[model samples]
Target: MKYQFFWITVLLIFSLSACKSIQEKANDQFLSGQYQYAINSYSQILENEPDNLEANQAVAESYRLSNRVEQAGPYYEKLVEEEPTFENVYRLGLSLKAQQKPAEAKAAFEKAKGYTQNETYLAETQRQIEAINLSEGIEDYFPNYELVNYTELNTAGADYAPVISENFMYFTSGRRASGIYPADGSPYTKLFRTRAEGLRVDVGNIQTLPEFQNEEGLNQAAIAISPDGNTIIYARGNSTSPKDLPETALFASYFRGAGFTQPIWLPVNEDETWWNSTPAFSPDGEELYFASNRPGGFGGIDLYKATKLANGDFGNAVNLGPNVNTPGNELFPRMTADGKFFFSSDGHPGYGKLDLFVAEKGADGNQVIKNLGENFNSPSDDFGIFFSNYPKEGFISSNREGGAGDDDIYFFEDKTPKPKIVNVLLNVFTKQRVAGEPDAVLEQARVVLYDSSNDQEGGDFSNSNGRVRFTLEPNADFTIIASKGGYFSKSIPYTTRGKTPNPEDLIQEVTNITLDTTIVLDQLILDKSIVLENIYYDLDKADIRPDAAVELDKLVQILKDNPSIKIELSSHTDDRSSDEYNQDLSQRRAQSAVDYIVSQGISADRLVAKGYGESQLIIENATTEEEHQTNRRTEFKVIEIQE
Candidate 1:
């Protein structure tokens, strides 16, 4: 027994020693910023101890830092299922969303929502859910862009973020001849410049900048040029050696005849440890845009704008605010020469990780951010965008399926042939219902149009001709409400489905298509009973049926539309049951209906329930069932008009 015990103890000791060795190595690699090596080292520990929380967390973070969050889903799921902590679950949701599993991601986010008291985390969770909803069916709309991979400019490594100034195009590429980076297992990246005409570039002429900017043992990428092509800034750092401290920040250089000046680290990066990259200059060169993960940001990384101070220095970096930044990373911000702003974000709710979007001035002059939709965004990382024209042509970078490298540059043009616009105008005529005569035009009636989502589109008062007109967009559903003083309001549903002329069919540059409709409002008359149809109770029962509830909802709407009107709800019975019993049952039914209306937000003080049993039957002597049904009825009429 002693010999057997000794052998088992030796084996156990060997296994534990191996696991400790691997754990120590992984921790070393993780702290030194070699996440890929750390991932492999930590994974070995997981093979022996799958529930090792430290190993699991490091491995998942490694994948995210390497820009492969799509592959971190399984590890994140394991972490969340084991711990169910807010951070774990929230990260799991992001991983799932990066994997294009939005539904599962949304559920994970909702679960994480219940576990946090942090306002920022809670707001981020809700934003993620909204993003999932906003991204649903995002591709089923009109597509306007046509993209082409610039094959001559690509290599087997990543080649992305192209910017043009004067006659040269500058970009970052991983084709630099060097040892592979341990983080992503790719060669070190450097900024390269080449002669180019729009989408056509001379790859043979490509060359790196001075050795100062393309320093050894660092990854220099994401280059941008100033409007005059005299100033250049690029993101640099992320040491290739474990002995060096790791960082990513912006560095700038200015033109000096044949060669540029020695690259100087920009002062806009106030914190060295905070991650700042993707620098861009505004068209006027008065403002600089970049992405950072500094403190007080709403997300993992946010876009910031820094204004140029006097004497040619930049400072006072300001976050783009919540309108343009969300709970996820926002990167690669750029502006066009024509004043249109664009950027890439994972927070804005789009096709997948890092989709392209644009921010513009709305009708109210507020910032309006809109997704570029499926045309420019894909189910993969699509970012590093620049536009040569205002809204027509641009170049974008992505790692989508057909790309030649990790992230390839593609030229895109708005090839949606400019369509002959057809104006769709809806004119509404408001008329009053006159007793025993044709309806008369009603002036000064309020008409409002709402879209399918119940958002008000337009509103106007009827003019001297009793007409209200609204311009309609193509393929929309609308609700038109007409209201006038001392009259019952009315709502009409309108649709323009299948009514738009196809672009191919339109010949004129502009076409006017007009449609007309009429709305008739009833003049309120006191004590005139309006029968509430389809409100029937079971025989001898006083409970309100589901059908009766449906009819009462109409009365509830009427009460809401005319706030100053009060009504009396009456119930009647046939001359079949005993007078006393019939009176009690009828009164109960009327009260049940009144209770239902009250439940729908109508005030009880504005309603009165009355029962007229066999004492006041509509049919004095009912013989057939139809006559009984007519006699046994419920109705409501205006009793008091406070207006």
Candidate 2:
């Protein structure tokens, strides 16, 4: 439900004329969020008193509130050019930003900065500039992700705020229900759900969640379920009644064996205030994060987290502080498993209305906030993101373009390269040498991944499905090694080298790739040669560059893992240089790599360096630079293995 209140300065059109009743009615309409009606009334007053300051301002504000931002641009432009008040220039900047003319909006903010003596206004203008820069550079925020509309779950009314539990996808909707909300004439919002197939939900089989519909006429929305899927907390708002007074509160329900228990008032809600709603629980169930317009907030609606006491009640709600909450409404706080905090805010520089943002502490322990970018956001509201598991695949709610109704749900996955990852699945198997023989699943196999670039190692055992899962970083080369007691160990290397964002995508989003790979293991054999690719040195130089170090580190790790194996480290050069010079340079390159591996704690006695100098060329008579580059290589062969 849309709350009725002025986000900007409230206007009171005081006139000493007989038409004061008309002006009062217009002010009442604007305050009640009836912007179109307010526009008509204000325009009638402006026809007679064209120069009336109150009437002109009210008309401009109405045009803005009704999402007709372009219509309000001229009035603000005129107002600022005449007497540039902070409110006029700031609102003008917003109008320009809404119209996609961010350059003009930035300029308007600059002008507003000069006109205001208040520090809050100055800081807000700077934030608007930051928002414009972020808007222009969206790929930086979200790198490699695709968003798909939840066509199955959406209706012709409003369908949003999807939460996943077991096989069901729970959400809130205002479709053709039994009763209509007097405030908006839409059907009263109710809890609904359907079957979930991974990220794709089965919309053809939608049904209402029967437990919470006992209330005759109320709007239900913004639900959060515990990780264990036992308890549910949702927002319930009554229809606009003289007794209800447009108030909303959070309610908690326990999941019984068959159905949900009777919902009762959540302890953190305040009865006097009408703005409390949209409750979310932390993953650990230790804290509750909720939105409220209670007194002493930054402004509008601010997010507050309450501690769950030992007595099963909540303690005093604490504001999330300026780090998360802003003067604009900060609603829908969802915490990921990795401690990332996701929320929606209009106060931040956004596309328009409300935009989804994620915040987390970086390695340096400072809070890092970023928008989800244009793919997940639009000119309207986008909030209520549900992660199946953080940094993997999940769903989000949006009232963006080309939707089935006012608000629709969308699914998104992480596509960017990172050091830490989530939701990566691998299938482990072993192949027999006999032709046409099917590979057998390698259950109970030990799978270990060594990140050569970062020197991190993680291991997991293959399950009954021959599946092993892991979270990985995207910025490194990984050596995936799999082994079982009776089978020979095999190793394969994978790199994220070519998975970087395109130049245009740099400002838009990070790329997330969902991988389902089969790792084939061969029986162990002696005298096997493992060639390391992309370990090239500069012409006439034996020093390693950053890229070469990444590959060389893999060799270092291989030597460290098979500590009892003595190996020969060899280097080959293209035939361009003279044999003496090439041999000498190649020897130095081999020695240099051996020394580097020894620096990483590999035993020096177990290694030998040799210069092949094109003697063992894989491609003889190579004419192209590509072929010549391939001839310049490095390899390590196991000469001896101690039992």
Candidate 3:
């Protein structure tokens, strides 16, 4: 009787194991975001039962959810062709659209639209068709920019999430020689530091941070440094599962005398139920922002900020609300010094995958979201934007094509941005000074504005009345030069510096300003020296002043425009000082001006520096203060014009 019972128990155990269905196993993996595993399970079921509708549908969905929508297309096409159900047809069209086959996707959507009885779904299908048609010819949204891939900091594996502190940049990378993690079968990510000098990053000093490593397994990669550079916060996982969907929490470390202390998990983490990562500190260093899948959030992962207490512990975390968080993930939350918040989301209408976005208050005190556009975002993942005190230039992490690794860091500069404006006009004109008549218009002269910082030049010839109207960017500086044949070039220093509205207003409101100005050029006469205006120095010093830089820039442009022209930069001083001292001071001032021009990329061999002290005063026997001021000036004489 005992032997029979033991055999019966063994048979019952085997039966129970075989009774577990493939659909149940696939469902478990699908819910856990292990789509690859789910795909394998469903594909196994379809191999034995090819026409199993449930298995085929699950297999297609697994491919779509895993960002392998191209692999789902064949399955969806076959299912729709055989079943022709409204749901199947609609899904087939979506799969085609994800592969960028808009025409075919539209045909599938139209076919599905005819079969759907639900009015809401039919309307949604029609909207998708219109959107696809519009996107077929969509223009790039952001201004032209230069993106520099930091190849020096990238490796054959993944590298991303960059944060700058002082002269060093801290980021995450899977470049270690240690073998791939058992989970995910990819190189484990660790914290790395290297020197970042503007856009020229160096990899020679790339070092894996020891204090932030996970000895037992792979640690989290996303990290944030404090404003004072003394503390760091990062994410860490508790499990070493192959799915890599371990329970994660945030941890903090302090920079002690020579190295960082052991990391300590923060108190804000839930009791092993939530997954947390991507920690960022506010510019003020008072709030810590991170992404969490905690309950009570708006569905998917939501961004939360916790206030720092006086005792160094975090307070209760607060949700960022719906303006920024969405039904999809709101990850990599970063704040610029100006209080503009940026994050990444897939729930928003984007070019598939994740896209970067900025959230701010509009003029009406409501939230406004702005997409960074294709220049900074791609169909692949783009997130983790970090600004260096200012927002004009910064670094971003992307998994776009042609990268050195899975996710590489890129630097961008908006040097000559066409800022959003409202009704600002630039009136270009030429002045013809006459003793008795109003300054007559000198038409047909060329008016050019050059931003030397960016090497961007734009201009137009004067109209019939010598007036060419246009607009310009605010809070920028430019050199406006007016020139014509037989005319000595005239340079006007222009600045669009004005008090900008609040951040919210700047995002939505436009300022109106009408600038009415005149540019004058004199007829060139041989051997005549023209005094460069606003060229001044300190009372007894020879250093070039800020005012002098503006004037010297114009001389640099002149040498560039007339490439073959040679000139002499001369400086003069008043007779108040001793003759010897005056001569020495003026010589230093002339050389300083010449050096400034040379720094602007002009050839040193094409110019000469001369000091004609009080000996060659403009106002001889000067007695009045105004006369002495006139003698203290700088001028450039055209020595030779090869043309």
Candidate 4:
């Protein structure tokens, strides 16, 4: 009998120890923000002791934090059903409201009224019911999005960045269509064109750009077309060179009025190093904008711009500055015919991952960017958005739930009211060196402008001049190109001032651009290279000031005319700071120029950005501010031939 009693005692001790261990774990998890785990533990205890009010209540609280209000509703209802107390009834009603069952929720609130007669909870519940009723009457401003894959087109590896133009849709995918390099030896992302047709559902018939294929790995995305559908600009990375990842740049090809022209790399100054991406053209095709991670931006990636000049050259680039850029990555910008800018971002607070945002030119011409709201966004990643100016239909790429693949393209329609017209100016120019003059004469060249930024054809060049001028609707960005034999072909950097057109300014003002003559081997051999003496920056700040904009803009024009040119962005800093910091600072400064060019619609791939920091100081042991400024300078170098 004593032995039996000893065994019973031992069993009792063990059971108590297990219970303590479970409770301790539950408490620890609860305090550590592991509410789901805590709820599971508490549930185990409640299963053994159904009437354990504390364990039951803990489960309810956990459910609330986890956004599982429907699960919490039953537990609270049971507590009220058994006790019929004012507190229990009120809690039950609250849970029902949270679950969004307004009619049933109201019934629970009415029951609570019988117990408490509290006017505040009664009024709040009544208000909630009314709000729900109101919300039901209004259509969800944001449409539900789902990604559908064209399995007939996509292969085993990757697919993304879809763009629609006229009857055809173009996208960058990793399919092994003819001319595509294999995944193992030569990895590349190529531009695939497809004809998409349908109303409620559309099917895309895919075809690869055979003529533009390169042996290098291609990371292509963010495509744009000219208004006449004769030119195309797309982003590309070095896929053929595996060691060269994240070195993606932008490239352009003419549609030949029949098929695509041979693809060519845009040029940059020799000193800078950075990757460019996401080319968007204004309606007139005079300006281009793209994103880059080069230095001098407010943060990671910033937008920049370049212009087409009279000499059939692209002028220098300008940074878009803080108004349109932030510390986080700003990418995939699309312009509407009305001059509104659309892009995806994670820096701004919204529903989740990367939310779609619209920025319009404010009355003062500054960009005012705003979130589209919760109905259009979720906790998952949303990106690569495009919109049509006509039917107003749009598509976005996302990895959210209900996608056909890893990243599916979602089609959506905008129900929001059409934006009002704001008149803006579109300009194009070219440069030609006068026979006897040292300066190049900026004159009208044959300019073709397209509104690929907003996925709409705005206007075409029926006129000849280095300059093509037109009234741009507000909320639009455009791409402008100029071509003449013997003179290099040039493209305008993408730009959007986002301003309401002042008729007064439009009446007399003209957006002027000057392209320069192509530097033949003879002329280039004479000078070889030119040093940019004025690419300056302030103390400790990488922000590109207006003065720097003037010079960089000039360099961009030079590249535009000579499509075969490739350049590098380089930075040098004084020896005052730590080498690492100086290197970083110099890199930032160099990137600032690259950012400016990209915002102008120069592709990131054309430019390579590097920072020598104090290592390449021009003025060693300089003590003066001017000397330090000399040391802390930025420069560019030509890298490759685009021809």
lDDT string, candidate 1, 1-643, tens digits: 9999999999999988987788788898888778888988988888878988888899899998888888888888888878889988888888888888888989999999988999978987998888889887565222777988988888889889998777678888888647667787778887788887766678898998643457776788898887887788889888865465357988888877887789888889988787999999998999999999999998889999999999676899999999998878999998877566789998887988999988888899888888888878888999998876656676889998888868898988777777788778989999998878999999999999999999999999999899999999877899999998778988888987777778578788887778889999987789988888888999889888888888888889789878889999999889888999999988999998999999999999999999877777777788999999899889898999994
Listed in order, each prediction's TM-score against the native is 0.62, 0.60, 0.55, 0.39
Q: Which portions of model 1 miss their true places by more than 4 Å? A: 1-19, 117-119, 137-142, 210-213, 240-246, 418-643
* Candidate ranking (lDDT, best to worst): 1, 3, 2, 4
Write one digit per residue (lDDT tens) for candidate 2, span 1-643: 1333442223332334437778888888778765666777878887887666676787788777554565688778767776689999999988888777878988989988888789887987898788778676665355677788878667788788888888788888887566765433457788887888678678788887865553657788888877777788888875545576456888889877988888887778866455777777788888889999888898778999999888766668999888788887789888876788999988776787688998988889999878878877887788998887566788888877798877888888877664333223333343323236767666788888788864647788888778776555554577777776534566777665555444344443444455555666543355665678999787799997789889988777656655567889999999887889989998999999999888888889988999888887888989999999888999888777777
Q: Which candidate is the best by lDDT?
A: 1
lDDT of each: 0.86, 0.77, 0.78, 0.63
State which candidate has the highest TM-score.
1
Q: What is the lDDT of residue 137 in candidate 2?
A: 69
Better of 2 and 3 by TM-score: 2
Off by over 4 Å in 2: 1-25, 31-56, 59-84, 140-142, 177-188, 214-218, 256-258, 413-643
Runs in model 4 lying further than 4 Å from the true structure = 1-157, 177-188, 197-204, 214-216, 240-246, 256-259, 268-272, 311-313, 361-366, 389-391, 414-643
What ranking of all candidate models by TM-score puts the best one first?
A: 1, 2, 3, 4
The whole-model C-alpha lDDT of candidate 4 against the native structure comes to 0.63
lDDT of 3 by residue, 1-643 (tens): 9999999999999867754666788778767655667777878878878887777887788777655565688888778878888888887887776666778989999999888789977977886677566554434434675567878777778888898888888888887635454323357677888788766567788887755565445556798988998888998773446565457888889888988888887887855668889999998898989999999987478999999999876768999997787666789999876677889875555554567888878899887877777788776778988875466677889878899857898888875645556555778788665446777788889888777484446788898899877677666777787888767677777776673343335654466667867976665555668789889898889898888898898889777766767889999999998999999999999999999999999999988999988888878888999999899989988787777
